[model samples]
Target chain A: MLSFSEENYLKAIYHIEQLQTEGASTNTVAKKMQTKASSVTDMLQKLADKRLVVYKKYQGALLSAKGKKIAASVIRKHRLWETFLVNKLNFSWDEVHDIAEQLEHIKSEKLIDSLDAFLEFPRVDPHGDPIPDKDGNMTKQKKVMLSTLKENQQSKLVTIKDSSDNFLRYLDKKQIAIGNTIKVIAIEPFDKSIQVQIEGREFMITEEVAENLLVEIPSLTLPKVKRTN
Target chain B: MLSFSEENYLKAIYHIEQLQTEGASTNTVAKKMQTKASSVTDMLQKLADKRLVVYKKYQGALLSAKGKKIAASVIRKHRLWETFLVNKLNFSWDEVHDIAEQLEHIKSEKLIDSLDAFLEFPRVDPHGDPIPDKDGNMTKQKKVMLSTLKENQQSKLVTIKDSSDNFLRYLDKKQIAIGNTIKVIAIEPFDKSIQVQIEGREFMITEEVAENLLVEIPSLTLPKVKRTN
Candidate 1:
C-alpha cells in the first residue's frame, strides 16, 4: 500500500512533468512540493525502488508505466470527485479542488469506477479541465491563450488551467467564466495589455492575466471583415 | 491537519471509548486498530500531545472534546460520502466503506457541508447507520437485536452492525436484507436459534447471526400472531 506522502509525491511529480515533458527536475519538484531537495532525493530513491519512477540524479524523473497508471488513476478519481462535489454536492468550483485532492488518493477501483458511472463519465471537471478517461486518455482540445487573439477578434472562454479558489475568484471578479463570449477590441504593444469587451463593456487586462485565460475562436457564420464591434 | 492514519487512530479511540464509556484500554484499542499494544501507546501519547485524546498509561485513552468533534466530523463526512456514492454514483452498498474511510479524512468543512446539502441532508447512510448532523450530533434511534424477538413477533430489518462483504453475502444467501419484513415464528430454546419467515419463506437462524442484525418494530402495526402465508 502506498503511504499518503508517497501518493502526494507521485502526484506532484506527474503534474510537474506536464509542463516539462522531458520529465521533472529534482529542484523543480522540490520547489513545487515546498520541500527540501534532499527530501525529494530521498523520496525519489524510494519511488525508484518501488518501480514508480525513473530517476537520474541532477537530471530529472519520468514516471514509469506503473507510475503513469497510478497517476492517471489518481487524476481520474480527482476529476470525478470534483464533478460529484460540484454537480451533486452543490459545491462551487472554488470549493471542490481540496476535497477532491484528498479523495483522489483513496485506493478503491470499484468506488471510482462507480463514481464514473454516476457522473455519466463527465469529460471535464467543474473548472473546465479535461478529465482523463478510465484508460488515462485526456481529450485533446484546441485552445489558445486569450493574449494571442488579434484586436476585434471574437472568442469564447473555453477552459481554465488552474482551479484553485483564488484563481476562480479572480476570474469571478473579472466577470470572466466558462462559456462567456469575449471580443478582443485592442492590444497595447508597450505593455502587452489587452482590452476586451464583455456584454458591451470594455475591461483592461494585463498580459499575464490574458495568458492565463484560455479561449477558442468563435465559429463565424458570415465572411469576416475586421471591424470594431 | 491530521494524517489519514492519525484520523483513523482518533476514530478508533473514539469508538472504543464509546463501548466502554469510562475510557479505552490499550489492548482494546490494539484489538480495534489491529496494532500492537506498544503502537497504541505511542499513538496515544501523540494524540494526547495534540490534545485530541486524554490518556493514562495503563488505564487507557478517551476522546477529548476536540477529539470528539474531529471524530464526529469524520463520521459525518463518511456517511455523506457513502450516501453520495450509492445515490449518485450507483455504487453497491457493499462497496462504499473503504472508500468512505479515505474520504472521511478530507479537511474541508465547506466541502462536507456542501455534500450534505447535495445529498439532501440524508439522515442515514446506505447501511441505515445514522449520519451525524453538521454539529456532530447523531440521532439516537432505539433498536433491538433480532435475537431478542419473541415467538410470533414480526418486525422489519432496519440496519446491521457489521458491513463486511462477507456478512452481506451471507445475509443475501439467507434472503435477509434491509427493509424486509420478518416474522419470528419460533425460538428454539435448546440452542437459542431463531426461526423466522422472510417474504413468506421460513429459515432457522442462529442466535449469533440474529444478534448482529438490527430491527425496528413499528408501533402503528400490531405483531402478526402467525405467519400470513
Candidate 2:
C-alpha cells in the first residue's frame, strides 16, 4: 500500500493533468500541493521508481495507470465521505472538506462499499462534484461557467470550480446551493459583475465568483413522437 | 495535532497502564505495536520531549495529563466509529474494528461531535466497550467474567475481554451477542467447562471462552414499603 503522502501526490498530479494536455510539471504539482519544487522532484523520482508515475528529468511527471487508479480511488473515497458528512451527519458543505481529506486515506474496500450503500450511492458530493464510481469512473457533466450564460437565460447549478472554504462560505451566505436554478439578469460592462436571480431573489455577484459557479442549461425535450405501425 | 502513529502509541500506553499500576515498559509497548523495542524507545523519547509522556532511562514511560486526554479522545473516536459502522451501516461487529482504527485518527472536533449527536450519544460500542465522552470520561460498568459466575446464577453479557477476530467469529458462530441474558446451568468439576443457557439455547463453553466474556448480574429492584409521613 502507498503512504498517505504518496497517495496525495498522485491525486495532485491527476487533477493537474486534467487541466493540461501534457504531463504535470513538478513546479505545477508543487504549486498545487503548496510544497517546494525540489521536494516534488524527489517525490516524482520515488514514484517513478515504484512504477506509479512516468517522470522525465526536465519535462515533469505523469501518473502511471496504477497511480491513476489509486488516485481515483482516493478521490472516490473523499467525495463519498463528504457526501456522508453533509447528507447524514448534518455538516455543512463548507465544513466537510478537511474531515473528508483524512477519511479518504482509510484503506478498506468493505468499509467504503458499506458506506456507499448507506449513503444510497450518491452521484455527486455536497459540492456538486461528480463522485467516482468503484471502477474509477466519473460521469462528466456538461456544464458552463455561470458568467457565460446569456442574459435572461436560466440554468441549474451543476458544480463549482472553486471549493475553497472562503468561496463555499460566500456561496452559503448568498443562500446558493447545488441544484438551485440560476438566471442571468444583466452584466455590468465596467467590472463584468453579473446580476442573477436565484430562486426568486435577485443578487449581483462579482465576475470571479460567477466564473467559479458551473451551471447546466436544461434541455428542451419535446413530446416523444409516436409512429403508427 | 498528533500523527496517527503517535495517537496509536498513546492509546496502547493507556491500555497498558490500565492493566498495570506502573508505567508501561518498552517491551510491553513493543509487543502491542508489533515493532522493535529500539523503535519504541525512540518514539517514547520523542513523546517525552513533546511532554506527552514521561520516559525514564530504562524503566519505560507514562502518559502525562495532556497525553491521557488525547488518548481518551482517540478512544472516543474509535468506539464511536465502530458504533456507527454497526448501527448505521449494518456492518457486523467483527467487521468494524479495522475500519474504526483508521477512522479514529480523523482530526475534527465538529465532525466527531456531529457524529456523536447523529448516533444519539450511544454509551457503548457494538463490542460492548464503553465510549468515552467529549470530556474524556468513561463509565466503568460493574462487570465480571462469565467463568466466575456460580451454577444457577443468571447474568447478562456486558462486554468481551478478548476482541480478536478469531474469538469474535467464534462468538458469532455460537450466536452470542452483547446484552444477551446468560444463565449458568451447570459447571463440570473435572474440566471447568460450563453449560450456559442463552436465548433458550443450552450449550457448553470452555473456561477459556467463558473467561473472555464479561457479564453482569442484575440487581433486583425491590418494592419499598409505604411509610406514614
Candidate 3:
C-alpha cells in the first residue's frame, strides 16, 4: 500500500541503479526525479525507514528486494497500459506514453491481470520495451544498436532505447516501427550517419537516432529458389 | 489540476448536493467521505479559494459551474472505467467499482476520450449509471422501480439504485442483471414480496430489493397471429 509518490521514487531508484550498477546517489535520484537534492535526501530517509531501500549518508541508495518488486510491478502496469492504448484504442505510439504514465498508477492486481489477459499478454509495449510478467519476471531480449550493424546487413527493428515523444514521432514520420525489416545500405564516414532501406523506402538517419534504435540481426539463411527458376 | 483529495471532495459534494437539493453541509460531506467535519470544512474553504465552490460559515457549500464540470468529468471517468472493467475485462459488476474508483483519478483527457470511443460510446455503465459525455452532458434515461410494476406486467431491468457489493452479489446469485426481461407473477400481501419470472425461472424477491431495482416498461404491441395451415 505505497503512496503514489513513494512508488515513483522507488521506480526512479530502480532505473538509476540499473544504469549505475552501484547504489544510486541522492543527486542522481534528484536529477532523475526533477526534484531538489535535499528533498530527495528526505525521501530517501523515509524510504530507508520503510525498509524499501538501503541508504548510506553520502555513499548512495539502493532498492531493497521489496522496492524492486514494487518498481517492477509499476513498470509492468505502464507497459501493459501502453500496449492497450496503442492496440485497442488506436492511439499512436508517440501519444500513449503520457496517458500510460497515469494509468500505471491504478492499483488493482485483478485489473492488471485481466488487462493482460485481454491484451493477449503482450511481451513488449509500443515502444518495444519489455513488459514484466505477472510475477515480475521480464524477458530481456538480446539486441544491437542499429548504428553498430555492418553495411549490407539485414536486421529488423526491435526496440528503441529512447522513447521520447519527439523521437517516436520522428520514427513515425520515417515509417519505421517494431518488426520492420531494414538493411544498412551505407554509412557516411564524416558524420557516421547511416543510410538504410526500410519497407522499400530509403532514408538517411543521423548517428544519434541510429544509436538509439535497437535492431535484431536476422539469421543468415540462404533463400530457397523454385525448380522453375 | 486538482489533487486526488480535491477531486474526491468535489465528487462527494456533488453527490451530496444531488440528494439534498441544496448546498452540501460539512457533516454530510464528512459522512460521504468518511472524514471529520473539521476536515471537510477545511477542504471546502480551499475549494472556495479556488472558486470551485461557493461556501459560507456553517452554511455549507455548493459547486460552482467549474466545480460541477470537474465533478462530471470525474464521474464520467469512473463510469467509463467501470464499463471497461465489466465489458472488456470480464469483471463482474460487483468487482469493478473499487478498480474504477482508482482508474477515475487518472488525469488524461485523451485517455478517457479514447476509452469512451473504444467502449463504443456506451450510454450507461454496468450499474445503470449514466456516463457523462466529453462535454459533461449526461443522457438521462426514464425508468421506474420494479416495485411499481403491477402483477403480470413485463419489463426489463435497467439499473440499480444501490451498487453495494453485497447487493450486486445478491443479484448475481439470483441470476438477475441489466437487460434481463422480468415478468411479475404475483405479490404477497403480508410481506409485500413479489414473485417474478426471469428468463423462464421463477423467484421471489423482497419488496426492498424490488424498490432498488429500476426497470424499463416495454411499449405495448399486439402479438403477431399465425396463418392457418
Candidate 4:
C-alpha cells in the first residue's frame, strides 16, 4: 500500500511530465510539492526501488506504467468527488476542489465505483476536466484557449486550467461558466488581453486569464428564415 | 490538526471511559487499540500535554472537554458516512464499516455538513447506532438487551453492540437485522440459549448473541372489537 505522501509524489511527477514532455526534474517536483530538491531526490530513489518510476541521477525522473496507473486513479477519485460535491451536494464549482483533494485519498475501489455510479457517471468534473475511468482511461476532448478564438467567433467555455479560488471567483464575478456562450469581441494587441461578451454582457480579461480558459467551437447550424412568398 | 492515529486513540479512550465510568486505564486503552500498554501510556502523556486528556501516572486517563468534542465529531463523521454508504450507495449494512472508517478522517466541516443535509439528517446509521449531531450531542434512546425480554414478549431489534464482521455475518445468516420484530418463545436453563420467533420463523440464539442484541418494546394499542346488534 502506498502512503499518502508517496501517492502525492507520484501525482506531482505525473502532472509535471504532462507539461515538460520529457522526464520531470527533481527541482521541478520540489517546486510543485513545495519541498527541498534533496528530499525529492530521496523520494525518487525510493520510488525507483519500488518500480514506480525510472530515476536518473541528473536527467530527471519518469513515471513507470505502475506509477501512471496509480496517479490516474487518484485523479479519477478527485474529479468524481468534485462532481459529487457540486452536482449532488449543491457546492459551487469554486468550493469543491479543496474538499475533493482531501477526499481523493480514501482507499476503497468499491467506494469510488459506487460514487461514480451514484453521480450518474459524470464525463467531466465541475471544472469541465474529464474524469478518468476506473481503469485510468481518460476520454480526451478537443479544446483551445479562449484567446485563440478569432474576432466575432463564438464558442462555449469548456474547461479552466487553473482552478485557483481567486481565478474561479473572478469568473464567477464575470458570470462566466462552463457551457456559457461567449463571443470574442476584440483583442488588444498591446497586452494580448481579450474582450468577450457572455449573456449580453461584455468584459475584458487579462491575457493570462484568457490563456487559462479553454473553449470549444460551436457546431454550425443554419438559421431559420421567414417565408417571403 | 490532529493526526489520524491521535484521533483513533482519543476515540478508544472515549469508548473505554463509557464502559469503565470513571476513567480509561492504560491497560484498557491498550487492549481496545490492540497496542502495547507502554505505547498507550506515552500517548496519554502526549494527550495530556496537549490538554486533550488528563493523565495521572499509574492511574487512568480521562478526556478533557475538548477531546470529547473531537471524538464525538469523529464518531459523527463515521456514522454519517455509514448511513450514506448503505442508504445512497446501496451497500449492505455489513460492508460499510471499513469504508466509513477511512472516510471519517477526512477533515472538512463543509463537506460533512453538506453530506448530512444530503442524507436528510439521518439520526441513526445502518447499524442502528445513533449519529452525533453537529454539536456532538447524541439522542438517547431506551433499549434493553434481547436476553432481558420475557417469554412471549415482542420487541424490535434496535441496535447491535458488537459490530464485528463475523458477528454481523452470523446475524445475516440467521436473517436477523435491525428493525426485525422478534418474540421470545422459550429459554434453555442449561446453557441460557433463547428461542425466538421472527416473522413466524423460530430460531435459537446463544446467550452471548442475545446479550449483544438491543431491542425496543413496541407501544401497545387497544384492539377494536365488533359490537353485536
Candidate 5:
C-alpha cells in the first residue's frame, strides 16, 4: 500500500546504488532527483522507518532487501511497458520513457504478470537493457563503453547508458541501433573521438557519443598502435 | 494538468449529473466519495476556482464544459485500458477494474491513442458501457432496467448499472452476459421479483438483481398482466 511517491523514492535509491555500488548518499539522491538535500534526508528517514532502507551515518541510505525487491519490480514493469509501447503500440524509443515512468507505479502484480505474458516475456526493453524477472532477478550481461574498444577491436552494441529522448533521437538520426557490429578502425588522439565502421558503413562518432554506447567486446584485449592526429 | 483526485471528482460530478439530471448536491457528493461534507465543500470550492465546476447555492456542483471534457477523457482512458486488460491480457471482467483505475490516470494522448488503435478501436468496454471517443463524444444508446420490462416481454441486455466484482461474479454464475435476449416470463406480485428466460435457460432473479441489469426493449412497451403467486 505504498504511495506512488514512496515507490519512486525507493526506485531512485536503488538506481543510485546500482550505478555507484556503494549505496546512495543523501546528497547524491537529491542530485539525481533534482531536489534539496534536506528533503532527501527526510525521505531517507521515512523509508528507514518503514524498513525499506537503512540509513548509515557516513554512507548515507542503503536499500534493504525489501526495498530492492520493490525497486526491481517497478523496473520490471517499466521495461515491459516500454516494450509494449514500442513493439505493440508503434511508439518510437524516445517517446516511451516518460510514459513508462508513470506506468511503473501502477500497483497490481497480476496486471504486470498478465502484461508480461501478453508481450510473450520480452528479454530486454527497446533500449537493450535487460528486464528483471518477477523475483527481482536480473540477467546480467556485462558491457563496456564503446570508446574503450581498441583499434581493430570489434564489439556488438548491447545497451545505451543514456536513454534520454535526445540521445535516442541522435541514435535514430545516425542509424545506430542495438545488436549492430561496431569495429573501431581509427582513434583520433587529438580529441579522443573514434572512427568506426558499422555494418560496413564508415563513420566518426564524438567521444561523448562513444562513451554512452555500451558494447560487449571480444575476449582478447589488444590495444595496439593505431592512433591518428 | 489536473491531479488524479481532481479528475476523479470531476467524473463523479459528471456521473451524478447524468443520473439525477439536476447536477450533484454537496451532501450527495460527500456520500458518494465517502468523505466529510466539509471536505467535499472544500474540494467543490477548489474545483470552482479552477473553473471546472460551478457550485450552485443550495443546489450542488455542476461540471463546466472544460471539466466535462476532462472527465470524459479520463473515462475514455479507463474504459480503453479495461478493454485492453480483458481482451488482450486475458484478465477476467471482475479483475480489471482496480488496475484500470490506476492506468486511467496515465497522461499521454499519444499512448492512449496508440492503445486505442491497438485494441482495434473498441466500441465499448468489457462491461458493455460505451467508450467515449477521442473528442469526448459518446454514441447515445438508451437503456432501461430489466425490472421495468413488462411480463413476457423480451429485451437485449446492454449494460449493468452495478459493475462491482460481486455483481459480475453473480452474472458469471448465472451465465448471463451482454447482448443476451432476456424474456421476462413471470413476475412475483409479492416481492416484485422477476423470472426470466435467458438463452433458453429459465431462472429466477431477485428484484435487486433485476434492477441492476439494464437492457433495451424492441419497439412499443405493452404492459401485460401476468403476475404469479
Candidate 6:
C-alpha cells in the first residue's frame, strides 16, 4: 500500500521508539537512518499528516497504531525470510540478515502467507526474534537479560536482541540456538562476567554479551535422569 | 528495475519475437497479454521509445537485443523463485507459478543472487524450463512434441511449452514430472489417442493432451536414483 522507502521510514521510526522509553528524537532517527535531519523532518511531517506517526517539530516521532502494524508486518516478512534462509537454504545465521533485509520489502501478502505455511509457521527467526502474526501481534515472551540471572541459577536461551552479523557468527560458533538450555554455574566477581553451561559444555560470557542475550527461567519439571538405565 | 507489468510486457514481446519468422503482430500480442489491442499499441510505443522494442505500426514489434537481455534477466528471476518455492517452500509444482510471477518483479540484485546460491544454482525450474545464467545466456534444448512421437518409441518428458497453472495441475494429477521415462505403446487410429507407459503404469492420452506435452526422443538420463546392493 505504501512505497518501499516510506515503509523503511516507518520501520526505522518504530525501532527507534522501541529502544527508547519515551518518544523517538529526530536526531536519533536521522542517525539510525543514516540520512540528513532535514530529510527526516520532511518525511516525518508527511507521516504525521498521514496519521501514521505523531510528530512535533525538533522532537522525534512515534508510530501510530496503523504505523506500528505496518512496521510489524515488515518485520514479520524479514524474520520469515531469515528463518527460510537458515533452515532451508543452508545459509549461516550471520549470512542471512542482509539478504532478508531486502526480501522483507517484497510486497505480496500471498507470498508471505504461503511462506509462513511452508516454513511450518515458525514463531521465531534464526536470531530468536519473534515472527509477528498476520494481525501484527508479536509472540510475547517473559524473557530477561542473561546478566539478570542469579548465580547458580539455570535458564534457557530464548532469543538475542542484536542483529549484528558478527554477533550471530559468534552464536553459531558457540553452538547456541533458540532452544538451548543454559546453566549459570558461577559469576566472576572481578568483571561481573559469568560462566554458563550449555549442552554439557561450559563457556564464559562477558557482561555485555550476557546483557544482549535473552533467557527464560525454566519451570519446575521432572528430575533429570542421572545414570540412565 | 521496472514495474512488474512492464517486465511482463518485455518478456511477452521477447517470446513472441522468438516464435515468428519475422516480427510479432500487435493483435497476437494483445491476445497473448489478454489486453485490448489499443492497450498493446500504447505500451508498444512506450517500449519502442525506451529502446526495448522495435515497433512499426501495421507490422509488429521485435525485442531489441537490450530488450531480450532484460527479458532473460526477468525469466532468470522467475525460474529461480519457482525453484525456491517448489524445492524449499514445499509448494507443489502446480502451486508455484503465481507466486513466482509476483516474486519475479522484486528489484533486488542481491536477493536474486542469494536465491541462486540458496537453490544451489539450479539449471532449471521444476517444470524443466531452463533458467538463464548470470549473464542472461539461456541453455538451448531441442524441443519435441509428444504428438510427434512414433508408436512404440520411447522418450523422456522434458519441458512443457505452456506453463499454465491448469496444465501443471493436470500433469500433477497424472503423476507426470520432468525426466520421467515414457513409451508410446499404442495409438488408436480412429481418434489418434495414444497409450503410454511410465514406470510400468499405462495411461491413455488424448490428442489434445499429447500436443501440449513436450518430450525428447530416446529420453535422457533418469533423474531417479537406483538402489545399489
Number of the top TM-score candidate: 5
In model 3, how large is the Cα lDDT of residue B42?
A: 94
When 2 and 5 are scored with lDDT, the better candidate is 2
Q: What lDDT is reached at residue B68 by model 4?
A: 96
Better of 2 and 4 by DockQ: 2
List, residue by residue over B1-229, the lDDT tens digit for candidate 5.
8998898898888888888888899999988777888888889899999999998666788999989999999999999999999999998999999899899999999999999999999999998999999999998689899998878788899899999999999999999998999999999999999999999999899999999999985568665666696
- Weakest 10 consecutive residues of candidate 5 chain A by summed lDDT: A217-226
Q: Residue A76 in candidate 4 has what lDDT?
A: 96
The sequence of per-residue lDDT tens digits that candidate 4 reaches over residues A99-171 is 8888899999999999999999999998998999988999877788888787777888889889899999998
Per-residue CA lDDT of model 3 for A1-229, tens digit only, reads 8888898899899888866689999899999899999999999999999999999899879999888889999999999999999999999999988888788888899889999999998999988888999778898777888998877787889898888889988988888989889888899999999999999899899999999999985566634435684
Q: How does candidate 6 score on lDDT?
A: 0.84
- Tens digits of per-residue lDDT for model 6, B1-229: 5676779999888777766657778898899899999999999898899999899888778988888899999999999998987887677887778777767887767668878987889998999988998789987777788888877778888888777788888888888889988788889999999999987899898888888878875545434445697
Model 5: docking quality category: high
Worst-scoring 10-residue span by lDDT in model 5 chain B: B217-226
Considering just chain B, what TM-score does every model have? 0.89, 0.92, 0.88, 0.91, 0.95, 0.91
What's the best-to-worst order under DockQ? 5, 2, 1, 3, 4, 6
Ranking by TM-score, best first?
5, 4, 2, 1, 3, 6
Candidate 1 per-residue C-alpha lDDT over B57-130 given as tens digits, one digit per residue, 9 for 90 to 100: 78888899999988888888888988988888787777788888877887887887777887788898888888
CAPRI class assigned to model 6:
incorrect
Query: Which candidate ranks first by DockQ, i.e. highest?
Result: 5
Q: Which residue pairs come into collision in candidate 3?
A: none
In every candidate, what fraction of the native interface contacts is reproduced? 0.87, 0.96, 0.91, 0.74, 0.91, 0.17
TM-score of each model, paired residue for residue: 0.89, 0.92, 0.89, 0.93, 0.96, 0.65
What are the candidates' interface root-mean-square deviations? 1.5, 0.7, 0.9, 0.7, 0.5, 3.2
Stretch of 10 with least lDDT, candidate 4 chain B: B217-226
Record all residue pairs in model 1 with backbone atoms less than 3 Å apart, i.e. clashing: none
